[model samples]
Target: MSRFAPNRYRGKLIIVEGIDGSGKSTQLSLLSQWLRSQRLAVSFSEWNSSDMVKGTTRRGKKKQMFTPTTFSLIHATDFADRHERYILPMLKAGAVVCADRYAYTAFARDVARGVSRAWVRNLYSMAIKPNLAFYFRVPLDVALDRILGGRAALKYYEAGMDLDLSQNIVESFRIFQSRILEEYEAMSGEMGFHVIDATQSIETQQQQMRQIVMDRIGAALENDILRSPLEIDRAG
Candidate 1:
């Protein structure tokens, strides 16, 4: 059990996840706006956004300087910083917390990079679970096509270039993303991810996600009346 789990929490931690082009970031941004429109206190966090490790991680990937093990450890450090600086503070304050990607990114991406799944899980065991976790599932080809269409070029890390899996970056992204998807699917059952079909229209997906968020807020509050924060009563 996590040391932080002993204390009662009033805030809800919601996480959205998927491959690079799965539209989770976009949705999370919109969700934050919608939550605020309802006058809820919302705090948003993104993967690798920690100031403590971002510069080092960026420089490493830019120079192709990190091995898989190094990359995994750096990400774990980044997440640990996030947990301390943003997640823990906001949740304890009873704010509704939204994360673009959480520790599961490490679980899937790190394991996909050949790191041990058990090791990665243990690395994140100290963290508290999210009140709601969303996994957007899109086909590999669809995700890559969406990515390639808008971007001028894929970043080396994004393409899994460090892994040396393929001479072609496009093919490499396909294979790498497929592995991540497999890991996420395997984890969804155990981790309680509410799977969202990414093939759906943006409006439809957003609507569904908001509904789930509303339902979860209700469930969490019902579980403990003292846990209500940034309340969104249905009648309101």
Candidate 2:
């Protein structure tokens, strides 16, 4: 489970992962924009944002009708759609692709929900390994507090309502997120996740993230590792 070395990739794929309220989305968005500001071509993608399956997924969630296996398959399909339609093209265009969450998200969440880890891994074998995968580590209480403060009600799946872990919403979310954090920690070594202490100020966390990403960008550019499917067309 060693990480896919950045040397092997055509374009940099940076993935940010964490439990709910861990600030992963915010940091990734900021980093992507910042890279663009520096004139690095960039394209952003997020989990479950594919148009092909959005309506179906939303309806399933609304009715709370998806079992663990069904939920995993739906998300896997969504990821596959986006990977083909959005991610691959961006990478082939030599754009830095920053994904809010990637395959590791399924490896953690689906396993926590009772899907077999090996099955999930095999399901995502089509995935392109990320060049940089950052795992935002936050304390359960802190994440719960932040989520509660921002929203009036927790989403059913996020609260682990599907698992029936607890009666109280807050307690359920806490239990669920804690399990997800444990799963994330377990995969850190195997996935080469750059773990960040999310308790740090947003500025500090972002600074550290940028420094690492910038270094990778420089190395990839120097090695000409980013020339891709459109190299001939672009040259013409």
Error of 2 at 82 (Å): 0.6
lDDT per residue (tens digit) for residues 84-202 in model 2:
89888888777788999998899889998989988888888888888888999998888888888987888899788999999987788788788888999999988878899999999
Cα lDDT of all candidates, in order?
0.83, 0.84
TM-score of each: 0.89, 0.90
Best by TM-score: 2
| Residue 33 CA displacement from its true place in model 1, Å | 1.1
Model 1 reaches what TM-score against the true structure?
0.89
Tens-place lDDT per residue, model 1, 2-117, is 22242358778889988889989988898888877766678888888888998898788888999888998898898898988888888888777899998889889999999998
CA error at residue 163 for candidate 1, angstroms: 1.2
